[model samples]
Target: MPASALEGIDESTWVDVIQKMDEVYSQLIDDEIELEKKNAELEQSQQFIFSVLSAMSDVLLVCNERGVIEETNAALCELVGRTDAELHGTSLYELLADPLSVERARTVLGNTNPARRGEGLELNLFDAQRQSVPVDANCTPRVAASGRRVGTVFVARPTAEIKRAYHELRSAHEALKRAQQQLLHSEKMASLGRLVAGVAHELNNPISFVLGNVHALSRYSNRLRAYLAAVHAGEPAEQLQALRGKLRIDHILDDLPSLIEGTLEGAQRTADIVNSLKRFSAMDPEDRIPVDLNEVIKRAIHWIGKGAVPDFEMRWQPGPPLMVMGSAGQLQQVLMNLLQNAQDATAAHGKADKLVSIETEVVENCVRLHLRDNGPGIAPEHLSHVFDPFFTTKPVGKGTGLGLSISYGIVEHHGGVLSVCNQIDAGAEFLLELPLAH
Candidate 1:
């Protein structure tokens, strides 16, 4: 029946079967072409990514769950001075230069999902020369399309350059701090020199007067003792009286008390000058505390005045205690410097109405202080450099010129500003502004 069925098959049925087979074959060829295109595209994409990884300067590594290096970038190969074939199948932990780092990496890799481990890890890696290089490393998990953990990827950067940079930065900071300290010391010495000069000049008269009076008193006492000895020797009362008269005992007794009083007053004046000098020259460089600007200003005024009221008419417009954080000693020195400068300017100009005005106000959360002198204003050309160290307008010996510069530094340390400008119609006006403590 099979033979008879085959013979009975029509030519048209055979042609139709052949046509159907051709159609199926054509469809298979088209599918194969599409598959090849997709494969080529995928290969191209992988090559692009591989090229990118190879081009990167940082070391990149792909490791399997066993912690065996499966793939590495050109950077890693070059760093180890090995070809990829030699690097592959190597233990990642063996590449670490530090024993502790190797142990840490091994422990981390023991986890089922080793990815997301070793973030911010600083490790020492061995180079081809067996020299250790610092590096920072990060790891992340590689997952397959089916959501299975396939491997771990590590990205690392050489930290030697960064460490060098950081070390350089710290050195620069230390140098800057040293320079600042030296500047502070220089300024303090300059202030101390000025204080010495002022004390010498002001105390000279009183001290000299006291010494002269003491010598005169000593001679008077000797004369008086001689007269007393004559009386004690039982000489004639008239003779003793004559001796006293000849010695001028009456006038000596009368003037002794006044002379002693003048000497005492002069001594007291010297003491006050010394005390003021001590207070004004206090240079506690590192003390910071809450202090009242008004009180400091008043003390400074008293010091600069040197016992007697200052020659210039001075007025203080004080506000409520303006509390600021600063060194009291330093602030006092600052005020003394400013006041002295004003005095010199006023005295030089010989103003008939020599007036120095000081005022304080609170504005915009800041404590503002203003000091103005009725003297000639600063020249425009010299105004900008007024606060510059060693800058001066007076005679060389008359001024060390560190007054304003040091004052400016003190104010800055207190988070304040000191500025000077010429007043509209009179002299130079200085403004000291400080931020109020919260």
Candidate 2:
């Protein structure tokens, strides 16, 4: 019955069905061709990546999520001094001679993601000789298309060159530090020597004056005692009193009172002078503290003005208290050096108008200090080297050239800047700008 029913239908309808089927099959074949193309491209890309890794100058390794070495390039194998057969199944630490190295590597790899770069750790890798060779290594996390967290890929280069460079830099730095310490010691000794000379010169006058005054007082006491003894000798008491009155002893005794008082006053003055000298020289080269610039200026100038170069007029433009984080003794040295310089420059020039003025104010966030002197100004050539070690303009016996250099180091350590410039008309002005603590 089925065969008989088929006899009524036209065969061309079946042709159309066959053609549709053929078209569908054609499309399927096309899809298959396209897939093969994609497959080829993927194979080529993998090959390219593998080649690049093999050619890399640094050791490269890829690990699975379990920290198992899934793939390693030639450089990595050679670095561990092992073949790929030995390294592929091994953990990163097992290949590294020390467990700590692998632990650090794991840490580094943990931090690696697409968002971060320029992060790495440098450590030592043991070579075949069991000697540690430095290596700079970094690892980052790599994710897979299966939506799972993959293990880290480590890329490291032998750090022998960098290690050598570091050793050289360290050596140089140590040498520089020693040189600086020696220079500082020499400078301290020099300063002490100058201080000794000044103190000796200063103390000699007071000592001499006191000694002479004591001698005079001693002689006067002896004479008076003898006179009293003579008066007390065996004559009638009333007669002796009458003789003393007749001589008008009260008038003569007035002169003696004056002499005694004068001698005591002179001795007190000498003592005060000696005390002041002690205070002035009490400066310590290493003591650091918060200090007022105004007080430092006043102390230095007052101490210097006591006996030597007393004719200079010092003027202070009082301003707000200038506070600084610095060494008190160092700043004192800087100011004292400046004032002494001013005095020397002005000694020959000023009769009464010899002047040194200290002015201070704020410039933005920095404190600006100016010490201006009306004296022989510095030449332009000497201005640049004022803070340089062993650079001094004074005659050979006078200046040791370390005062300004040490001052420069102190200011630099405090993050301040010091500079000197000659005034437009005459004299020199030093500018010190110190940034306030933030």
Candidate 3:
């Protein structure tokens, strides 16, 4: 009967039906292959996402609109001491440590405005031990493909870690400041050390003068004592007169005043030198006061000249006091550094007439001091870097290169300006300008 029924159907029709069936089967096979490829790609994408979530250090949680936990990363699971399966259906509010946090979370999750979504909202969450842990959290609305807000994604970082980072940064800043101060002090000491020879020579002159005056006074004292003893002995008037004449009492009397004056002058000079040295070597004070620039320059020159070569000369005219506002000690240091650098520059060139000439002028509201040296001027290329730390043309051991840099800083701190330029005539000239003290 099946064969009779097949005979009733045309062979061409059967052929057509077979062809249609084959086409349908082939289409099914192609569709199955396509589906398998898509599944492989989906698995790869899921694995990539999982790897990323596991690698993140911050807590991540995804919840539905009802606040039911739909997904969580490894960090959240480890923090709460729960597996993904155990936490899947749990309410987000149940993980909060306090009612306040729960209420805040509710407000944040309920917000519909994307721009007003939770940003840096601090919340306390229950940890593995049920202890509250503070975190800075950001919550963003997670929209589905249909453009509907389906849930909220929470990303948070522990506050303790942020606070620790801030503490470390502040500590580093303080340490850096201390190190800078130490470096400044060390450089000052080095500069002082370099002037030892000059300082000793400066003290020598006053000390030697004092010693000589003391010796003369000692001799005069002896003569006066002998003359007084003769008078007290009740010797005959003529004999006393003879002793007085022999002792040259009138001459001694004439010289005594001069000798005493000389001694006091020498002692005072010595005291001044010692005081200057003490001020120079001591740390600069923070207080600013009116300082006589002319006096400071004179002292710097006097000290630096004492140990310089005999031919080295500084030409400066005593003028009415140029008063400025600054730390006297710091100003002295700047002057000394300038003078020393000039002397070195001249000496290095072996100029026969090594001279440094300083001139001062009163500009509006400021006093400008120009120091010029008769030696090789600064090179065009090196002019800009003269005040840079550790930049020097001198031999490695000959200079520390911090003198000008420190001086520049000191001048700026004093509300002044220090600059240099190659003089057109012969050498480099440094100009220092300071505001006049009211």
Among these predictions, the greatest lDDT belongs to 3
The residue-by-residue lDDT of candidate 1 on 1-438, one tens digit each, is 588779979999999999999999999999999999999999999999989989999999899878899999999988877888998999887788989888767665666745454455677788899888888888777778998887778888999888899999999999999999999999999977865675576678778889999998998999999998998899998898899999899999999989999899888877865554444343454677789988899899989989446789888966788898778778888889899999989989987889899999999889989999989989999999898655788873466466787788778878899999999996999999998866
Question: What order do candidates take by TM-score, descending?
Answer: 3, 1, 2
Tell me the whole-model lDDT of each prediction, alpha carbons only.
Answer: 0.84, 0.72, 0.85
Give the lDDT of residue 405 in candidate 2: 61
Per-model TM-score, in order, reads 0.51, 0.38, 0.63
Superposed by TM-score, candidate 2 places the C-alpha of residue 130 at a distance from the truth, in angstroms, of 18
For model 3, how does the per-residue alpha-carbon lDDT over 389-430 read when each residue is reduced to its tens digit? Answer: 546788733664667877888898888899999888879899
Residue 130 of model 1 has an lDDT of 83
lDDT, residue 312, model 2 = 75
Alpha-carbon runs more than 4 Å astray in model 3: 112-118, 178-201, 231-265, 271-424, 427-438
- Candidate 2, residues 42-157, lDDT tens digits: the string is 99999999899889989887887667888888887777687777878777666665667767766665654533343476656766666676677776666778955577777788
Worst 10 residues of 1 by lDDT: 276-285
- What is the lDDT for 274 in model 1? 59
lDDT of 1: 0.84
Cα error, residue 214 of model 3, in Å, equals 1.8
The list of candidate 1 runs beyond 4 A from truth reads 1-15, 86-105, 113-137, 156-378, 382-419, 425-438
